[model samples]
Target: MIETQDLRKEFRDGRTTKVAVDGLTLAIPPGRVTGLLGLNGAGKTTTIKILATLLRPTSGTVRVDELDPLRDPKAVRHRINLIAGGERMVYARMTGRENLWYFGQLYDVPRAVLGPRIDELLALVGLTGAAGTVVERYSRGMAQRLSIARGLINDPAYLLLDEPTLGLDAPIARDLRRVVARLAAEGKGVLLTSHYLAEVEELCGHVYVIGDGRHLTEGSPAELTARTGGHRTVRVTVPGASPEVEAAVTAFAARAGTVAGLDRAGDGALVVSVSHPGEIAGPLTMAIVGAGGTLAGLEVTEPSLEDAILALNDAAWLVTA
Candidate 1:
């Protein structure tokens, strides 16, 4: 639903020019959550602003649903909703219901439909009880919920959520995640940007990692994990002494890919990482036994989103090895 080719945004100072985003080519599919993840000052906000039609890209082309945002800003606004990070708050003086009603009116939602939409969104975001209370009195979580309701005022086809769960408590963050999933399931294309790697992994089917104002990598969570080629770590603790087990792990490491790293603690415990996690149990076990080791317990560790992100951060290793 969204595509950008060689997107670049540049800022000029007295003598130096800085590129906030450079050569960023990306595609966000319909009915899927696509995460734009990066650390602070990594150009996430700049990218989102350009996509939302609030800022024009310095170079390249951007199309949302085949509409050029720069040429048809009005039409683009009608089709997208952007709940900016740290800024999804309603008018503090207006009641939650009033805030929703006002935003709905701006979206041209008919007065007859406004009431029902307000009620539905308030309930959807778990703010039904505070619908009548002024936003100024609402807690941070309540205001965040109301902001979400405002974003849905137009029932937008594309949702741009920048840190939707930034300041919420755990419970509220979980609730927001559920809401985000439901929106996508309803066929809304979503571009979500957040610092929370776990949240992005849970919500986004695909992700684009940005670093140093450039596109570092883009792929599904599993695909990116596989590309990193980091060894999968396995931890084992056996009750009795087993010298054979040590030899087995080393041999499995060599054949499976590379042990890469190993850590042994007191009490006959071993932590082993082989090039591939799939060979951890069967091949590793046999090797341990051949060395006269008896297995008492075994646990496998798979690559996480954090591991993939770390690999993205290492510029020297990217697209090289």
Candidate 2:
């Protein structure tokens, strides 16, 4: 397990000091995909770097399988690998196959073992055909895939991914997610940092919400959303409703008085935004029916992970970690 307690990091410029990670506590256990979520300047990447032994913490304790990263940085590096989103990791001049082979060699894997491992990784990232092609020719998504392949070359016990799917197309991101799932299933602890909350909710067993380098809250995606008393949308569609139905909807909207506003969608659906859709949905459905309108569909859109996290960050409720 890789865990931290009250971890903090600060940078200094002359007399000014800026804290990058402030009192962050999180745990990533083997066979589980844990997510570290925050806005761009929220210090998520700083925390990941500390665990990967890239940056030394200013305070608190960090353990990678019970070994102190500061005390045994070399051992920590050997046991973990970080795949940052971008084209910086792979060698642009090298072929996709050569890049993996080179990283494998650096990790000191035997050529006999490394050769086949490279092929497996290339296939895993859908870069098998592009294996012989120089990385310069690979597209952005392909490069990101190659970067993922390189991170796995060492086959480390822990993997840290920073924005692994930042700019990739939907299909490419889906494929990378599968790779992440496979890694966890194989017993490697995966620590993921991403702005894509839906992806995090889908892949992570638990998530740590952070802001301004401080821990906001940590829980299963559902728990976090349940804790969030944010707004929910109850969409009521009355297909080809008479003007009487529209007037009824307008009156209901007046009575309900949602601060988020009730809207008429482009397709003529009535979108009612509220803090509690559960309390209003039944009456909302009845209003259309009482107006002599045929109800086409009624759907409730719950508070998503992104919504919950944003609410959590905005509230800044401090919880004991």
Candidate 3:
């Protein structure tokens, strides 16, 4: 398990001091994937670096498997692997097999054991056929595959993947996602940061949204969506609508826990907010007709994860304002 309490990190550049992470608290339990999401300069990388023990937090408590990172940097490092996308960490001059062997040696894996381990990792990453090929000859996807192999060479219990599928074609990205899922299934805690919200929604069991070096919200995708008011917008057009029909629809909306607003489509339409349009569409239509209003048209629009994130940011801005 990984846990952080009131984590904060700041950098100083001569006269300027920049806070990268501000009192961010989170946890990553074993056998699950946790997603860290944010725009540029949102402190995702900073938080990851601190957890990886590459950078020390200015103030906070960081523990990996009940071990403090600052007090036990080497031990903490041994339990975590940080795999960053768009990083050419492997030597282009060496074969894929050689690169893994080299990293295994760095981790002090015995040569007798390292050979078979390298073979296993190459096979695990589906790069066995290209194991003898030089990394310089490998494509971008192949290089990323090798990078993942390197990260696993140490057999760490925790993994940090930063944009693991960045700049990949659809099929390749899907394949990598499968690999990541397998890792999590193997009982490793995985912390993932990605620009692809769909990927996060598919893989992550829990997600954290951060903005301007602070955490905005954290929960399962469904919970965050509901919390951010990411509901379906249903527009019901009623021809020659009367005040009675409007009042009935308004009452229905309030009962459904949503606000009904008047639409100036010039067709006397009412825009209703709802978590699920199917749950209320038929009932609303029937109610309007019962009130002597003709249902001319209806439209339903569902919100996306992008919409949820934007709403979170907007709320954060309002709070800080």
Candidate 4:
């Protein structure tokens, strides 16, 4: 539903130009949550602003549902809802319900549609209890909840969320993720940007990781993990392990595939990284036992999206450095 081809954005300072986004080419599939991940100042915000028609790109093309955000800004804006940093620009004097109702009116939603839209948004964001309270008295999380409600006021086909859960509590963030997932499942396209790796991994079907103002990688979370050789992180806890047993685990991990790295977490536990996951369990179990260590737990975990993105970011930095 959202596509960018060679998208670039630049800013001019005194005597130099800084590129905020560079040749970013990516797509967000309809009815799925596609996460846009990057460290702070890594062009994620720039890209989202361009796609939302709030900022014009320096070069290249961006289309949201076949309408150019730069050329057909009005049409694109009508079809998308862009919420950034949760409460960035919400009016403090209005009540939570008032905020959504105002947005619904701005979208020119029918008078008949406004009441239900406001009610549904308030309920969806768990702000029904404070629907009439002015936003100035609301806590940070409450205001954020209202912002989410505002984003849904028009029921736009595409939702562009930039750091939607950035500073919220764990419970609040979890609620927002569930709500966003539900929207995507209901056939709305969602493009999300987040630093919380677990949140992205849990909610996003595909992820586009960016660094150094460029696209580092884009694929399904599993696909990116597999591509980074990051899927085979194994955590093994043994009752007691001798030096020989540690050496054996290392050797077995090497034999399993490429040994990316290894570390020990706590008491007699070893975390090993294998490039590929195939046949890791049987060999590692045999090796530990053969070297006089009783296996306590041998569990395999896929590396998280954060880990994969950091790896990709490191690789991108290496290329430019």
List lDDT for all candidates, in order: 0.82, 0.86, 0.86, 0.83
Residues 1-321, model 3: lDDT tens digits: 999999999999999999999999999988999999888889999899999888999998999999999888888888999888868779999999999988998888888888888999898778999999999999988898899889889888999988888777788789889888988999999999998998998899999999988988899987787777776767787767888988888887788777777654544465433444335777878878888888777887766677788888878878879
Clashes per model (N, Cα, C within 3 A): 1, 0, 0, 0
Give the clashing pairs for model 3: none
lDDT of 4 by residue, 177-207 (tens): 9999999999999999987888888889988
Q: How far is candidate 4 from the true structure (C-alpha RMSD, Å)?
A: 2.8
In terms of TM-score, which candidate is strongest? 2
lDDT of 3: 0.86
Q: What TM-score, to 2 decimals, does candidate 2 have?
A: 0.91
Error of 2 at 130 (Å): 1.4
Which pairs of residues collide in candidate 1? Answer: 244-291
lDDT of 1 at 315: 57
By TM-score, the better pick of 1 and 3 is 1
TM-score of each: 0.87, 0.91, 0.81, 0.89
Candidate 2 residue 202 Cα shift, in angstroms, is 0.4
lDDT of 1 at 285: 61
RMSD of 1: 2.9
